[model samples]
Target: MEQGSHLLFWKAVNTVILIAILYYLLKKPISRFISDGINSVVSRFEKIKQEKEEALNLLKEAERKSQEAKEEAEKIIKYSQELAEKEKQQIIAEAKIAAERVIKMADEEIEKEIYKAKEELKKFAAKKAVELAEEKLKVAIDVESNKKLIESSLQKL
Candidate 1:
């Protein structure tokens, strides 16, 4: 072989030895770093999944509580309506009774007034009759007739 070719061959051998030594030195560290990164990524993914499940459970619980609240509100509204209706009925009944009582009282008062008016009319008629009778006697009985009546009454007595 020539000298130049022999030197190039030695340089190629030296380059191969250096590359192999570097690969051997870096292999374990690089592999360990890649494995640790993969484990971290898997752990993070699992944690996220667990968090999502917890969020879904919380949402379901909130929905259930909301439904219960709605049911309770309906019941309360129904009860209030029933109570209001009962109160309205009671008030109407009480008003009717009060009206009846007022009407009865008015009737009794009217009757009393009518009776009083009749009594006054009877008294007025009796007074007028007495005055008329007195006037009639005064006109019919002259002085001479009165003297004769007195003499007859004395004789009878």
Candidate 2:
């Protein structure tokens, strides 16, 4: 029993010494490997964060451009509408002037026709009166009356 106890004590001391030697030899390499891995992860995280920020900036720029384009389009539409309205007013004014000119021409033509008709009627009435007076003289007077009328006109002169 005494020999077994002595042997166990030596074995325990040997195991402890072996463990300490292994620890001393491996500690630096393990720490270096862990730090390198952490550095790699941190660098990758920074790169991702920078990319996200760039993408957000690009989105904001695109939104600004879109808003500008919309405003420009509205301006163009407004200008086109104003131009159309102006053209419409000009066309309407031109049409009114043309209509008035046509109406004036028609009225002038009507007045000319009425004057011509009145002149023709006056000529016709004068010719008809001359014919009626000649016929009445032939029916009512004889040769004796004509001789008397001539002698009286001569005596009076």
Candidate 3:
């Protein structure tokens, strides 16, 4: 009975040592590998998140640029329209001024021509009156009646 008890005690001691060795060699190494893998996966996820954020910021910038371009185009169009309207008004004003100047010049020329014609008519009428008075004097005077011409011309004319 004493011999059997010693053998049983030795066996129990050996079983405890095997369990300690397995825990140190296999269980601890497996736990370390699983922890490293989990950390690697978390780091990859963080990298993807940063990339997504960068892409979103780029998209927002593009949209802002598009809106600015549209505003610039609108401003250019408005400026062109304003310039065209101003040109049209200026052209109309110039044409009206030119027409008025032409009409005024024509009226002045007509007045000058009329005044010149009146002066010529007056001179012609005075010359014709003198010629007609001489013709009437010759007809009233006779060749042998010089002494009595004044009394005869006064009665005949």
Against the hidden true structure, what lDDT does model 3 obtain? 0.89
The deviation in Å at residue 85 for candidate 3 is 0.5
What is the lDDT for 72 in model 2? 100
Between prediction 1 and prediction 3, which has the larger TM-score? 1
What is the per-residue lDDT of model 1 for residues 1-157, given as tens digits with 9 covering 90 to 100? 5899999999999999988898799888888899989999999999999999999999999999999999999999999999999999999999999999999999999999999999999999999999999999999999999999999999999
Model 1 regions more than 4 Å off: 1-19, 132-157
Candidate 2: worst-modelled 10 consecutive residues by lDDT: 22-31
Per-residue lDDT of candidate 2, residues 25-103 (tens digit)? 9788888899989999999999999999999999999999999999999999999999999999999999999999999
Sort every candidate by lDDT, greatest first.
Answer: 1, 2, 3
lDDT of 2 at 10: 89
lDDT of 1 at 32: 89
Instruction: Assess the local accuracy of residue 72 in candidate 3 as a C-alpha lDDT between 0 and 100.
Output: 97
Error of 2 at 9 (Å): 8.1
Off by over 4 Å in 2: 1-29, 124-157
Ranking by TM-score: 1, 2, 3
Best by TM-score: 1
For each candidate, what is the lDDT?
Answer: 0.96, 0.96, 0.89
Error of 1 at 49 (Å): 1.3
Q: Count the backbone clashes (under 3 Å) in each candidate.
A: 0, 0, 0
Whole-model alpha-carbon lDDT for candidate 2: 0.96
